[model samples]
Target: MAEERLIIPKKISNRFLMMIGLGLVLLVAGIVLMMIAGPAHHDAHGAAAATGHHATTWYERFLANLWLNNVYFTGIAIVGVFFTAVQYVAYAGWSVLIKRVLEGLGYYLPVGGVIMLLVFLLPIIFTGHNPLFHWTDHSLYEIDGPNYDPIIAGKSGFLNIPFYTIRLVLYFASWIFFAWWLRKQSVAEDLNGGLTFYDKSIRISAMFLVVFGVTSSLSAWDWVLSIDTHWFSTMFGWYVFASWFITGLAATTLTVIILKQNGYLKMVNANHLHDLGKFTFAFSIFWTYIWFSQFMLIWYANMPEEVTYFRERMGGYEDHYTWILFTNLFVNFVFPFLVLMTRDAKRQMIMLKLVCVVVLFGHWLDFYLMIMPGTLRGDSGFGLIELGTALTFLGIFLNRFTKGLTEASLVPVNHPFLEESIHHHV
Candidate 1:
């Protein structure tokens, strides 16, 4: 069968415009809501008496939102390339029909990477008042100073600005290189018509997997785990990856559904949808397993340091994160598990779409829980700031994503397994 190239309709274009416009309005409003309280935080004594104690500044809260969001969306973008690379390495045939969609999701990587670097820098540049990462302060390492922290001093060799900056650059550099290289090979294969590009992609993908094995984990450690400064987890790397991977799977599935509904991706069928649903279903369970293992181990160990992490999240004087922590498990695990359990449900696009949307928001909340608790002690970070910021990010991501789809056929026509994908069945 001949592949159909995407010619984005006027309505879809208009829809994205409206989405972007609405996002911008909300983003402006969220920015005001977040920053409106900025002036009150500055005081000679350095404590806001109004909130009594532990009253974090609005900039701190804003930076927290920015940091978590940068990490969250960066994971989403990298996992796109990661998913495609995995498909290639496994010699997977059933996913060929949806491969371009994955590629489009991935093309958002360079943008996300730049945004991450900028967000990381913003905390340091803003009068050296880093609410998102308290460890970044140089005073904490001064042994003679009143602000001295033995723990932070000990970890300073790794957590220092120069080393952390290098890793940030390298992670994005490597990830971007792989994303670009594979995309180039894919386009070459489409033009030249051979297995040469395909085999080359496998080799490159294998190398990428090895690189990712190290970087993804370390990046997670740097970006999210280090926020708490004192807590550590063996399960954190995979835990973050699971949320990212499954969220990418759901987003990819959702994009395919939208394209099909708009009268594109002609070779894709219900069987393809079912396969996508199955991947989403399986990964939701996988994510749950990782989450539960991490939680249960920490709960059982009862170690002061280990338990402190969950203690803050599970209970506080404010009890801020307790509900959202449980809600994260339910949304990411239970909802998908129960909804996508049956064969019929997997085959149904409506069910798949529903699961995908919820899973996306669920993982957003998951990241919110991870980062917000560390930055702001008394309040839940589940309001306009998060929602508007995410929508703004979505609009930017969609613009890049749609542009990528228009650059190539929605179906990769020259793929060796294109026929297998067209006829894919459960």
Candidate 2:
């Protein structure tokens, strides 16, 4: 069978404009709320005075929202490249049909990397405040000062600004290089047929995987785990990888469905969709196992330092955020486990799409739980600010992905395994 080449749609519809408009409105609203709430925070005095009372304000919550979202989107982008690279390493044939979609999803990496770096730096430059990360307080390292913290001071060698910034640069630079290199080789392969580009890609992909395995963990530790300066978890990195991996699976599944509905990816059939569904189902369970292991080990040890992480979410502010744990587990694990357990349900496009959407939001809430509780404290509440900010990022994600799709053949015609992917079946 001759492969049909993909054609980019000449123009995006008015619905695309509607998406942009809605994103702008939500973004503006979120920014307005954050600006208005700015005065409530006492940056000069920090979250606590010399008297040792913990206080939080709405601006801090806004900062928390920004930080959480930056990492969330970054994870999504990283996992996109991760999904593609893993397939390349394994010489997987079934995924070649929708590989372009994965590449498109990865275009968000450079964009999101810049945004996250700026968000991390904003407090230090403009306000002389570090609301998201309290370790930025130099006084904490001063042994004689009122703000002295023995724990934070001890970790300063690894957690200092210079090293942190360097790692940030290296992580983004490395991921961007791999993403760009792979995409370039893929398009080049189309122009000049043969396995020359394909052979280079395999070697590059192997190197990328080794680097990603290490940096993904380091990045997770730097960005999210450091939020609570006192707590530590050896399992934190793998746990984070699982969350975004499953979430990325859902997003990829949804994108394929959308493309097929619009008369693209015609080669992808029920069998392909079923395979995607199985990944979603299996990873959901894998994520749950990691989630439980992390929680259970900490709970059993009963150490104040480690247990405080959960304690804050459970008892702090009357359990405002505790319910998120249940919701995350239900939507991500239980919902998929029960719904997609049967063979028939895996091939049902509508049900799979719905579950994918649900799992995406569920993991967003999972990240929210991880970051928000550390900074928001008594001020923690889910409202327009949080919802609108998420909407803004979602719009950005979609806009970039759609624009990226237009740049390449929607199907990689020269890929050696295209035929296998086209005729893929259980």
Candidate 3:
């Protein structure tokens, strides 16, 4: 049998282009808004400085911090796509139907890298306040003052500007290389039908997984945990991994459903959906286990530093914290566990779609809980900025994912396990 010819529809490409264009515009607008606001804030503070009454606007602080957090959180999502692709490659499954979706996500790795690099370089570009990370305050390292955090001072040797920049470069390189390699193998398999590409990918994936494990842990610590330098959790790395692992799975499942619904992926049947649903179900449990383990350990130990992290989250932001716990457990754990426990539910499109949506939102809330506490505490309002940033990323992600799907064959025609996948059962 001849191989299926891949063709991306013009409409899909155009839509993707529109989404990218819109996202770019929003990003530019956000930057401009901040730039203008920065000077006005400085002017206001300057006037107050003369009278020895420093006036700082809450709105200005909120916007600045919100932008910083958005950049970091989005980086997590971008890294997530690469993690998902690595898993698929390692498993060597007949996931050709979703390969393009993963590839589309891979495209963001470079863009994400650039965003992170820029965020890290902000202190250098502009002598602005370090709302997101306080370590950027060089004066703290120079003087042993009351305002200086001892913990940050202790880690200064490793966390200094030069080392931080070097680590960031290494992380981006590894991700870009892993994404490129995996995609290259998949594309190569299309031209050369055999297990050679498969074997190579498996080896590469194994190596990449080890690298991913270490890099992901350090990345989480550097980007999120370091914001609150006084606190540390051994479970933090595993916690981050669980969250993003499920996030990647949820994203993959959602992308597949969208394609199937739109008549783009006819070859992907109920069987594939069942497999994806099982993964979604399994990971939901995995994420819950990690969440519980982290929380229980810290709660039980009652160590001041360790416990303070949760205290800030639970006490300071009681409402958001409680809602987050409920959503994480009910939507991510309870609903999926019960629904996907059955053989029939896994194959049911409507049920699976519903669960998938919940899982996606659940993970989004997971990221929110993880990030917001450390960054924005007092008034973490769900305002236009949060909504706009999320919508912008979603629009861009969907556009790229769908267009990438159309570029590759919906089914891996020459894959060794293609038949097994097509006829797979619970």
Evaluation by TM-score, superior candidate among 1 and 2: 1
Where does model 2 exceed 4 Å of error?
1-21, 30-55
lDDT of 3 by residue, 1-426 (tens): 334444657887677667656655665554465466653333211221222223334443444444444444444455445554465565745465566666666665666677677766775557744556667777677655656767778889877777888998898788788878877887788778799987787777777787887898898788777777778888888877777777777777777787778766677788788888888888889988988998899999998989877776674444445555566688879988998899889888888888888877777777666665565553344433454466566666565455555566766666666666556555
**66 in model 2: Cα distance from truth in Å?**
2.1
Model 1: lowest-lDDT 10 consecutive positions:
42-51
Please identify which of the two predictions, 2 or 3, would achieve the higher TM-score against the true structure: 2
Q: Note the Cα lDDT for every prediction shown.
A: 0.83, 0.82, 0.67
Cα distance off (Å), candidate 3, residue 225 = 1.2
| Model 1 lDDT tens row, 21-82 | 88668756766764675544432212232334466655566667767777877787788889
Ranking by lDDT: 1, 2, 3
Error of 3 at 89 (Å): 7.1
* Full-model lDDT, candidate 1: 0.83
- Candidate 2 shows a clash count of 0
Candidate 2 global CA lDDT score: 0.82
